[model samples]
Target: MAKYTLTVNGGNKEVEAMEDMPLLWVIRDLLGMKGTKFGCGQALCGACTVHLDGVAIRSCSLPVSSVGEGKITTIEGLSEGCDHPVQKAWVQHNVPQCGYCQSGQIMNAAALLTANPTPTDEEIEQGMAGNLCRCGTYNRIKEAIVTASKSL
Candidate 1:
């Protein structure tokens, strides 16, 4: 095992783990941060989405050693008391169904808004395309993203 010092949510976290271990496991299992979920370990699903230096990435497929010095931001770090604009928009639009994929969805939306505060509809669609909500809440997700953009 090797020691890795990760910058997560503006804090430094030290963990001892194998190099091949995925960041998802490190965040959830080791660090006890459970907001980032594991859907598909192959990186196909967006359920493990987290911000790596402010860019959204699939933590499930990202090895802990590969993270280097990138700042990781999970859903829990998005805001205090889940009061982020995207989160607020989600509540306003009632975007959760089953609530399994909402964390990743909200994280992705927050990153998109951070990069492009006023994204167009096509941009929002493309940005959120990777995240799948089995409950078919895509319309609500899109509306929430748009609402968040306006609020941000």
Candidate 2:
């Protein structure tokens, strides 16, 4: 086992984990942050996406050792209050169906807008391509993103 330290959601955390243990497990199991969901163990699914030093990463495929001291942001950290523009837009657009994938979708959208506050349609599509929403809420997601971008 190895000891790794991470700055998560504005707090510092130290954990003991196996060398190959994925950060996703550490976040959910050790640290008790359930906002980052586990969809697939592989990196193909974006459900485990989190901000690692301001870059979106699939936490399931990332080793705990690689995240030492990096600023990690999960869904819980996305909003200080309950009013992140994206969250508001999501409500305004009524984007959730089953809601299982909405957290990943929102994380990806937040990353996209952080990098490009006013992304084009193609950029939006490309940025969010990795996140899959089984409910087929793509149009609503796009509309919410655009609406959030404007609000931001």
Candidate 3:
């Protein structure tokens, strides 16, 4: 086991774990931050998505030791009172059904908007292609992204 100090949500978190340990487990189990979900361990699902230094990454496939000094941003860190533009747009558009994939969806959307403040429908689709919502809220998700962009 090795010790890793990660900058998460603007804070320093030190964890002792194996080099191959996925950051998803470290965040959910060790750090007790459950906002980041575990859907597929193989990184095929976007439920484990999180922001590593402002880039959307599959935390399930990211080894803890490989994070280095990257900043980790989970759904809980997205906003203080869930008032992020994307979050507000989500609520305004009623974007959640099961809500399991919402966090990752939101994180991915946030990262997309960060890189492209205003994205076309095709761009939005391309950007969010990785995140899957079993509830099939694709239309609402796309609408919410456009709404959030307008607000931004």
Top-scoring candidate (TM-score): 3
Superior candidate under TM-score, 1 versus 3: 3
The per-model lDDT (C-alpha) reads 0.93, 0.90, 0.96
Clashing pairs in 3: none
* lDDT of candidate 1 over 1-152, digit per residue (tens): 99999999889999999999999999999999999999988887799999999999999999999999899999989899989999999999999979988889999999999999999989999989999999999999999999988887
Query: Please, what are the lDDT tens digits per residue for candidate 3 over residues 26-131?
Result: 9999999999999988888799999999999999999998999889999999899999999999999999999999999999999999999999999999999999
Query: TM-scores of the models, in the given order?
Result: 0.98, 0.96, 0.99
Question: For candidate 2, lDDT tens digit of each residue in 14-54?
Answer: 88999799999999999999989999889876889999988
Per-residue lDDT value at 2 in model 2: 81
RMSD of 2: 0.9
Q: Residue 28 of candidate 2: its Cα lDDT? A: 97
Assess candidate 3 and give its lDDT: 0.96
Candidate 2: give the clashing pairs. none
Better model by TM-score, 2 or 3?
Answer: 3
Rank all candidate structures by their TM-score, best first, as comma-separated numbers.
3, 1, 2
